[model samples]
Target: MRRSSDLSPEIAEEAAWWRDAVFYQVYVRSFADSNGDGVGDLEGIRSRLGYLELLGVDALWLTPFYRSPMADHGYDVADPRDVDPLFGDLAAFDRLVADAHEHNIRVTVDLVPNHSSDLHEWFQEALHAGPGSMERARYVFREGRGFDGSQPPNNWTSVFGGPAWTRVPDGQWYLHLFAPEQPDLNWEHPEVRADLEQTLRFWLDRGVDGFRIDVAHGMAKPEGLPDMDIRPQAPGVLSDDVHDPRFDNDGVHEIHRMIRKVLDGYPGTMAVGEIWVKDDERFAAYVRPDELHLGFNFRLVQAGFDADAVRSAIEHSLAAVAPTGTPATWTLSNHDVVRHVTRYGGGAPGEQRARAMTLVELALPGVIYLYNGEELGLPNVELPDWALQDPTWERSGHTERGRDGCRVPIPWEGTSPPFGFSTAVNTWLPQPNEWDHLTAEAQLEDPGSMLSLYREALEHRKSNAGFAGEELEWYGAPAGCFAFRRKGGGLICALNTSGASVPLPPGKVLLSSGPMDGDQLPPDTAVWLV
Candidate 1:
């Protein structure tokens, strides 16, 4: 659309909001704790509306706050229709949505449809009901493999670790692709489909703008739940390299079509799927007109701090989504992975690379998701072993230290522990003392700080006409460096990934991720120009 003609940013945002919106991911429990209970709640998020508005995000993708057992930190849904007591009641959630909209920030919520908490009434009923009962049919329950019915139904393993099956007291086994406490829902079941539709209606009626579907690649298993010859992902990676029978099943498309039908009833609402398929044709299928409005392509997040790797990621991600006529989505970190700062190389150098990367990301053409505290240049906190809580940790027999580091409560404004996140001294995960210098309070006033750079970059991305483009054209650059111009707006974005500085592109400098070296872009730094 941008290449064809100029559309005011305001008009474009209204016409198709998800096309170019910047969404901030609020990982609920660690964002802000309102009642001083040491865990972030709905009220805490409502209180932070002003901060988010000031940060200039178009929407807030709040992670699940539904009635959960917290077994998977809210991903384990017990009651999808109501807010958990820990996060306050439905009234609190409604208030948060209303307040967020008042600040011009649309609210999207996480919807976990792949599985239900084992404590869910249906699952609990399935436990006691006979093997052939209708309740059992709502889940993927199957008979055991061996003669004694002692072995699991299949050799498949959980993404968290161990076997993907768990045995019941009745001697039958059920599939659980993650933790045993989370039982996979039988998407083929009419009751399950109806319930999910009702769920979409329930949340939409409550004013939720859209949904960020969890495990969007999962749900529909192939007929005769088969075995998967899987390769174990490396440590700290819940990686997706494709060719796993566990996910990205062809049957899953019909599920997305059903969800799309429900979402279509609400004109302004959208659904963005967290798909992990690597085949471009298969990945593109998830975003077809009758499917998800947006499907997250994580190629960029998996790339290292190298220019060639980053270039390849962008090109492939763009190509993957091109067939569907959907805009590409870009992100560097999320609640599940190690933060980009630490991944690039920890300490001052890491922060510099992160700042440079942020500029590069913001300059891109499609939807962008920012993990909370990323704007403040937060790095993964190496918490003591005693404090780790990710399910991956216990499931892997403590051999793997899961994602607790990136999920640490972000520092808001104080110089000590909790950092004004909560009035309580102890938090869900202890905050490191080193964060005294990285708190938002400490960075807001510093022009050179990461927060300030983010603010400046966001303002330009939102208001500057030069950023109006649906795609970018590559520009020739020196080795270990790459540059691109937004196809329509002529906005130039350049990154110097090499060890030596390079001359800036010929344009009016708009912003720099680091201090400029005369007329040059410094090593490991990025810049935006018009």
Candidate 2:
């Protein structure tokens, strides 16, 4: 494969650029705000191109920026073909793509094929055209089951809260695994398939390198829309083990195959799915040669900061993709979950654990998607009750706090809330006051800071040529420690998950997540050796 710096169309079409690539996930709404609307936009991302380039990421996976009602923070796409006015026009998107390519960075946007906004033209037409109309066939619209059609068609629950079926004024119930405003599409319809294919080509033609498909596992519902027999888990959690009839249906693979056919025509362009299949063999199906190029395995994210748990998570993730010849995608935090720093344990301990896991994720084969503020050791904000914006907040009867904490605008500069995120005092989500010390600018000057660790680590990974291949050789370690060597790279990555320090492996120290305790690797720390 050619270097990203000299990547030409010929090279792009022929090479697997995604493998071993480091992608940064940019939640556009919270990234930056050039127009000072208190919400990030395309131009804000453009202005930060230099910063991203300096960070040494190979590509960027952007969350949805399409025309949306913001019901699900851009996931409720009203028009897949156009940029939402909230994030600038089509020209701004084109410019962002151009600028990204100029910086030798690939750009991948989110594609939400599982559903569309209720305000979408197709859905609007369906609402106006009445029952049994052709337009209604585009989405999942069925009659309620009760005598007077008062009950839902099925007992399925929404991922957010309550019933998955939303009743319309016409006495019809529509399927929405997520929020009601985001109605699930009838993937069985030929028009839906054709339209999504068109949408894929539209962005690909505009120079987007690939797509991170949203809720990719939910595209194909079961034949009868059967009632799931399992008890519900916590809100917003979908485990394949739960046997939720709403997800991982056999028909989904056909949809992926169709998507892959379009992507294959564009060659090197990738289609990464947000697949949550827990069964290894079933998960492997999504990444087969004819389907998605990559399927994110969230086991690592869900694992605790303990040796056995972390090791098992890694082993499981690798095993799932090993059969398909696809590299496992690694990530710790994203727009949908609580930040890893907080999840690890929070405070100084959480930061240390999060920093250590970063090394583990990067050392692994395949792609690493770093959420926008993770490199800064940003913790999830404790937003005021009124500041919550996730639909789950209201949908869950105000019981669950939802994901608004993690979606807070990133701290770029300044010493207060909004930081450098916006010129306006009111940001869409409030930034925590404690984040002043964690701002990129504040951390840039400190060699010991989280941002510095990421920059240095990325630079080393790129220049050393030790991360070129996908082979890991595991080494037995002390009870609370684990180590793995990159095959033929003459490099080793070791971690100490125990409270007590452990002996450093035999090699020259390349990098460490924290200061070593003499010859010992400290607890909650990771180190790279050469």
Pick the lDDT winner. Answer: 1
lDDT of 2: 0.89
**Candidate 2 regions off by >4 Å?**
1-14, 234-242
For each predicted model, how many residue pairs clash, with residues at least 3 apart or on different chains? Answer: 0, 0
Sequence-dependent TM-score of model 2: 0.97
The CA lDDT of each predicted structure is 0.90, 0.89
The digit string of per-residue lDDT tens for model 2 on 89-148 reads: 999999999999999999999999999999999999999999999999999998988689
CA-only RMSD, every prediction: 3.6, 2.6
| Candidate 1 residue pairs in backbone clash | none
